[model samples]
Target: MELGLAGRRALVTGAGKGIGRSTVQALCAAGVRVVAVSRTQADLDSLVSECSGVEPVCVDLADWEATERALSSVGPVDLLVNNAGVALLQPFLEVTKEAYDMSFDVNLRAVIQVSQIVAKSMIARGVPGAIVNVSSQASQRALANHGVYCSTKGALDMLTKVMALELGPHKIRVNAVNPTVVMTLMGKANWSDPQKAKVLLDRIPLGKFAEVENVVDAILFLLSDRSGMTTGSALPVEGGFLAT
Candidate 1:
């Protein structure tokens, strides 16, 4: 189970909370140097308090110029996790331009922009780095009031494939970890109601949602040499939701 990720520096977006925070902690435990990026300064402070050596950067990924400026100087990231994303749930008929723009900016556009920076560095330094995009099962299956969110993730999966295709020659593997609802604090609160949760829970053959650790484990595997043969793949940690 050794990921062989020790000593490799990684940059993880949306490191303030949920899966991003857990991923940072896992990487730090594996002896990987981490660059944690989140817009909220307080979250960054708290994360560093917990993990100690995390290099925290406060920047909103939705801002094109700001993201570039913040990441331009991080200096040769050996691993990249494009985990910063927003879920602006809206019915297909009610989807607005603002929601669409913000969702696309953070979910898809920022991924391309960030990866461009990291992949360039990897190629230049001859680093056979890996990139893990945090996509969702919502990309494959439709959810009520998640039209815009689904579109962004669907695009993200395609982007992951194309990135892997081009970056494979450089030994820069790009893949996505598509998870179902991970049981973060917020997720638990949202799904605590059995009647509401049953609607989706019944669809999952495993009859359970995933935990942050579940998704994190998958991500580390993909980022490590253990998954060296995996590239341009969207590995699902969705607890058999996709199967049913």
Candidate 2:
């Protein structure tokens, strides 16, 4: 599974932990230089200690000015992963403006902001690249108390399609990996309860949730030449949850 991605430079958002962290390690192992972006300095510091060739960038993706200033000078990136997101869960009736804005800010708006910066660099340099938007199964399926989160992800899916249509001509592939409740820090905090976990697990044909590595594997494939022909795809890493 050598994706022929060695020596490439990649920028990964939300690299503090979970799937983003794992993806950084995987890319580094494959010989790619990585710029790890996270809001937390401690997470970025810890990541650099474990992975070589990592350039850590700490910026809150939700901050328009800070995000632009930090990533606008990122130079040329052959690959980009828009994995940073926030899940402000609230029942549909209970959803507040604050939750709506925060979810949209980190989940969708920051994606557009970061991708525009990276994609523009790629276009200017005439470099063929890949962009992976870390969407969610909630994008296509309804989940209680996830009104705002689901809306952002659904918009992200459409955004991926539009990016492929527009950026494809420039040879920049854009796609999304829609994963079911991955056992990330957020996932464990929400689903560690047996009663809650079983409610969703039973719907999945595989009767389980995904692990960080499971989603990271999909991200790497989409970023690599292995998926050269793949663009505008919403690859599901949900272990049959959406199927059932």
The number of clashing residue pairs in model 2 is: 0
lDDT of 1 by residue, 105-196 (tens): 99999999999999999899986999999999998998999999999999999999999999999999999999999899878987899998
Q: After superposition, how far is residue 70 of candidate 2 from its true place, in Å?
A: 0.8
In order of appearance, the predictions have TM-scores of 0.98, 0.98
Model 2 lDDT per residue over 95-173, tens place: 8988898899999999999999999999999989999999999999999898888999999999999999999999999
lDDT of 2 at 120: 91
Task: Give the runs in model 2 whose Cα sits over 4 Å from its true position.
Answer: none
Query: Which predicted model would earn the best lDDT?
Result: 1
lDDT of 2 at 53: 75
**lDDT agreement with native, every candidate:** 0.94, 0.94
Runs of candidate 1 exceeding 4 Å displacement: none
